[model samples]
Target: MPSTDFLWWRDGVIYQIYPRSFADSNGDGLGDLPGITARLDYLADLGIDAIWLSPIFPSPDVDFGYDVADYLAIDPRFGSLEDFDRFVAEAHRRGIRVILDLVLNHTSDQHPWFQESRKSRDNPYADWYLWRDPRPGGGPPNNWASVFGGKGWEYEPQRGQYYFHMFYKEQPDLNWRHPTVREALLDVFRFWLERGVDGFRLDVFNVYFKHPDFPDNPPRLGLRAFDRQQHIYDIDQPEMFPLLREIRQILDAYPERYAVGETFLSTPQKAARYCAPGLLHATFDFTFLHSPWRPERFLRAIQDWEQALGDDSWPTYVLNNHDNPRAATRYGRGEDDARLKVAATLLLTLRGTPFMYYGEEIGMRDIRVSRSEIKDPIGKRYWPFYKGRDGCRSPMQWDDSPHAGFTLGHPWLPVHPNYRHRNVEAQRRDAHSLLNYYRSLLRLRKENSALRRGLFQPLTFEPRRLLAYLRQDEHQTILVALNFSSRPVRLAMGRTLSAFRWRPLISTRDEPLMPRDGFLTLRGDEAVILEREA
Candidate 1:
């Protein structure tokens, strides 16, 4: 509702909720639909326009909901279909849209389709998954490797065939080339659309289709076996684009609907095409998530995205997700919210739509998981060296209580040890907490049109550590200056924006920060949003 003049996806913020870790109401220590429904008012107060829930479909929990077993049903661990309907209705009532994560690329090995497909080649679902025969001698069809650190091909002795998987062996890649397979997956979208899911975040959508020939991926210099190959044949195939168009057609039939994608190994150039007109509405740019904690790096990622967008496409940015470590830990000093406040300012004031991971508002840090405590298969396979994603997928910290107020029962993953002090309840009471900082930034963007749908204009001013930019429209012009360093910097207003009168809208510093003697002095690790007047 901030910018009623533009598309909601283009002008609004989306909050990512990993349902398993968000909240648990059933005392089962796993988050559920009803748990989310109970927290609608909090999300509404946080000022997000939509909530992109990670996969909640029925699953064997092999991949923690990503290996979907049933596209039309809810996982019993999460709740029932009726509970999901109530959650969506509650979100809609609070002016928050619901975007379900659709994993069209693969399914759990236990899925009925795979069960039948693996029994024999003549079954109705025999071709539902990508099943191939062994090589001439006694090896996999090609040299494709799984993303979770093993050979991508799993030999099924029952069917005497090997199925390809881009991720874990539990997740068998679907045969999107099969007309029936495509139709069945597309129908999954329609089912959820009819159920009032406002949009979908297509999981690993770029890998939906692989090369028909199943050729061996060319080798490259890299860290591990999976990264050693160029992955030219396994991902970003031409066939996926047409499927996106078909999905777009289905979404277009409904009003105010949306669809964004999560491209495996996402790139700006690919996003340019994936978000092209008549295709996806947008695709998550992980550049912001993986970029170094530097001012120039962030500026470069923002500028690159601007150049990559076509005439009809928009840019979406992400800094944290379930699979990545929390940005608060990546970019901030231990127990310091200064850098987080600065990052929040830039994330909220940028040209594109910003995505907030759950618990990011209170500056949640990653929960370190030891090898014995790891739940993620990725962590188990690559422990001590990589340590996997379980650190970031921990339960949300709500209060300083047993299990961080997530549940009375044990949590699926450990809550961050710092949750006792850094949590929503404690931060809610502190005026200067990171939670309040996010609320202020969201409120500022909502009240200012120049900050919401205006064009982004990067300022030439900088000491290399400070990245300043302007957001301008016919109505007003706003300046956002961020100091990435721990030392203050002074920027002179000698030309350009200096011609207009300015007012300070918000800043990370406790004291009022404004220009003095035609110069703006920024505190260490500080960011300020100022509105300029003619």
Candidate 2:
């Protein structure tokens, strides 16, 4: 049983499964709904409270599932509606809540609403999407660029007008100003809620609203011209808050259901605003995910969040996800797999809900995306500069089998070059594989209540090359210490140990750090969890 209150996600851990990359049951080289259905036990054994499945709704595959063609139906490439029902049922039976990804800011151009909206300027659906007259000289409506690296507006030959698509051209932005569109989307929400879903992870949650006047956004100031623009006209619009409240009202109508918004823009103070009581229950804290591998940077970012967000609202912390490169490639020193496992220990022991992206447990590295293998539109346009998200979105490495056991057919995306060295089958057999470390860390997290909801405070250690902290409650306290450097370090506790009994609960070293007296001497790349003496 979960130690924390059964709030669905109060300091709960969530495993994010990108369905197409998880596993494939059929020989079709693509992961489908039934494929994910087969993986429930894998997730359940990980001891997570919820599973955040990426978009599985019907889409044109323009941006994969992000470009939804129908708000209420499952994509045929995945499986039938009945398959999803079974997935939900099986997950619930295993004590895992299923949270679907809701992409509401836009829809595919192939959607019926968009089809009708583009038919004529006088049609009832004409205002359902953002439409604008072409520039006087017959060009795009503005100089704004799509996130996928092209003009944000696409001109329609039939209507002689342009429509806004903040992302890909196939994904046109929906006009929230339309009462009918909002109501229709709410109906879709009700459709799933009635189907027994626990909640939603709103994708691009902050990007749902736009400037009402269709004004041209001014250029950005500090970063690149793209980063310089305040996005005043494109995103973080003021209207999004009220809509969030309305959405929260809808969600609150259901029992034990929660909503988590993905806001990657800023720190916790900014992220916490999305979690303000009546809106989202939690928002993604992406600061740690973006920071360099430094103990000070990590400590400051986590402390900054606690100070900014207050103690009442829950926080979500993640190391990697479908959008980012694997942490092993980003933070690991070559051949130093222990560093990666130590990172996992920190992630699971942190004071917020931990989100483990699929394949992260196996220490998956970013798949090399060659120019020819590139499929993501963003990567195609950005090329060498960005390389898009395909590298990180490759199929999971289940084994050394062809296609890493993801499929018998050619996968939608190619597997990584490191598949043989790092896969589930090899790791499961190897006692020291990163996968086992993750399982042990997860089990440790579940066994200790203090690790779940205790106050977080950094231990002022010899901050030269080590990171240490303590998780404590009224009856129990655990000290977590990690050596971040490649050299041995001596850390003295300084009379802080006199009144308490102490025992070493966990150590990443092949041998104990040293005799437990007033200090602990740790070797390179080692982490230990210590319990207070009773």
Candidate 3:
């Protein structure tokens, strides 16, 4: 079982803010720390407990901010170190915790450490990165493939050797086996912790360590070249466990601090291993992110994650992020706001920490960016078949103004075309807007103890389209029902729920749903939460 003492992160909701797209305060066409500081009031109004900011460290923008050039300083495009300190202070003043994105697995090739390491074999920092001699045939050292496509090894003539990079060629994997490297990375964590960061979101955490032998991955049948191999030597090695324990020790030194890991191409069972007493507090469950809108698919994912995490572990859920397309564009094909309401209700009522991406509350869809305006390398490589992530990483739609009121200058990416009507200002005025629905759902989750920390019990129903579950505690039991189809559903309460008086608390539709003859009716794309004493 988990510790009897409660941690705020275990029960709180996290709002993910892609700093570059959130708001531009200086009219520079890019969002900055000051821009986010100005929006603290808006986030507080949304009832979020914490804000997880994506990487803001200095970078060459190869893979956006994932390729970090410096661990202790802020990117010039975003702000200075003083601006970050001010942002953290302002967020805490509003009762909102700030979580920074920590990329320890790799660094930009332009980093001083990598630059020195590539100079010569006798350099002090030569062992700081993974360096190896070429194969006997003068090709790459191994058969490992980069995630961005092509061989993972890059021939660097400077040292007459090849360097390893898992993502882009601009990012070289760090040598975690080196003690000096480990100490340097730990100091980075300490630097941010002393600066008042409440937590960290570990990026590609599972791939920090690789097999020492540098062996070739076994071939497997798959669509992508990277997926064509089993990836046994590239990631998820047993060596990661001890490193995580050391990281946990650093975080435990701080009061009420937390760390959540992002597992790349990992299963729930694999993710659970990193969340014991001395490792990560939680790991993101991607089952829901990849699942369709079908009820059975979602039910299976929830049950699988809960079972895998077991009683002693905690789970986190995310429907959309900087990498994936918006949920509204995925699930809400014909029905717009109605589908969004159901998604929000399901996210908050589920048994885990809910993470909401910015602009998701206002039914923001993925903007179609042309090839000429594309900024992401992945999208440029995939072209018409896969248009890349620029669509989802567009600027937030604040209002029906020029550039969606995100900037006075031309925004980095185009705002959604529907921003004229779908924006925070327009939705805040309407009571039935998707933004209001999200606010009410968050408020409901915060007010009800049963919804926040209660045990999850999947309720069985005959209707194949309805997804029902019960969240129960000693004081109350809340039943949540969601209709996934376009047709109405009439669900029978049966003897199990006949004894309790089910009163409607909240629903997607404007009118309240009343039970008649021990049966409840749910309209098309409707969801409801009913309360009864336990």
Candidate 4:
């Protein structure tokens, strides 16, 4: 069980704010710090305990804000350092913690360290980034492909060597092998901590170190061509754990502060190691996000995580993020968007800290970006084979107005065309809207201790389309059931649970649960929370 004594984050629900798409204060068609400040009350009323703002640091927009050019300064487009201070202060006054995104795995080429490192091989900042001498023919040092595509190494004419970059060519991988480099990154963390920020969500935390010997990656047999090569030479290095310990030590100095790492490559067993005692506080589990919508699939994934992480390390759940397509697009029926709320209910009710992506509460579907409209580098390069994240990262639909009320000026990316009937304002008036459902669910989750820290055990002996689980503690045991099929299911009146009297708490329908003879019939897609009675 997680320690209940300290840290507000243990029970906190974090709402992820994709800064560029959240709001526009100055009519620049971009979200600024002040824009976020304006929405604080809306978030507070939604019952979120903390906010995880995506990157707003200075960058060249190579990959939006992932490529950091300056760690300490806020981008002029997002507002200034003073604006951040006000936002943090206002959020804290209203009882919400703020966690900033810290991207230390790589830095934009425009960064001062990268600028000087590219100049020569023996400069003071030369070792700050990964640089190696080229082969005899002067091609890239190795046969490693970047995540964006093509060779991972970029040639520098001035240094006559190849430099490593896991992302776009403009974002060079930092040399964590260098002592000065590690210290410099820690200094960046301290800069934010000293500025009164609550914590950090470390970006690409698992890719901090690579093989010191620079070994060649072996190709795989049946995996995707991209996954064909072993990542042993490039990532999931053992040394990265020690770096997390160091970061945790620094973060421990502050009060009510916590850190979560985006360590994607680690296995369920290995991922837990990053969040176990004396290391990072938490690392999100992607097992659910990666799994398809299947009863057995979800059951197995949750069980695997519990067994892997054991009882000490906490797990986090995220159904959608900026990188993936929205859950409404991926998990919901194409014609009926209300089904997406079923997913939200599942995520928010499960034990762990839940993260809701921007626009997900309102059930916003993915926007369609045509080939001519695509701006993402990955989308542009890989066209017909795979459309990039441009569709998912389009501007948020705020209301049923022009440009979805996101901006008066031209938006960086076009809003979804279906924003007419599926926006926040339209949903606010409807009693059964997705936004109100989320608000109700969130408020219920906050009020129920069992839902927050309950032990999950799935029951599989019943109907194949029925998903039922128990969240129990000594004082209370709550059963949550959902019907995934189109037909009504009469919950089997089995001998195991027939003796107990059950009281209904919340159901998708308005009627009270009839516990006559200890059996209940549920409609298609219906969900319920029941409490045991004496």
lDDT by residue for model 1 (332-360), tens: 89899999999999899987788999999
lDDT of residue 66 for candidate 3? 96
Q: lDDT by residue for model 2 over 394-420, one digit each (tens)?
A: 899988888888999989898987788
Candidate 4's C-alpha runs over 4 A off are: 1-7, 222-225, 461-463, 516-518
Q: Is candidate 1 or candidate 4 better by TM-score?
A: 1
**What residue runs in model 2 are displaced by over 4 Å at the alpha carbon?**
1-4, 135-143, 222-225, 514-517
Q: Name the candidate that leads on lDDT.
A: 3
TM-score of 1: 0.98
Q: What is the lDDT of candidate 2?
A: 0.82
lDDT of 4 by residue, 249-339 (tens): 8988988788988875656786787899989888877888887766567767777788888888888888989888888888788647545
Where is the poorest 10-residue window by lDDT in model 1? 1-10
RMSD of each: 1.4, 2.0, 2.0, 2.2
Name the runs in model 1 displaced over 4 angstroms. Answer: 1-3, 461-463
Instruction: Estimate the TM-score of every prediction.
Output: 0.98, 0.95, 0.98, 0.96
Error of 4 at 93 (Å): 1.5
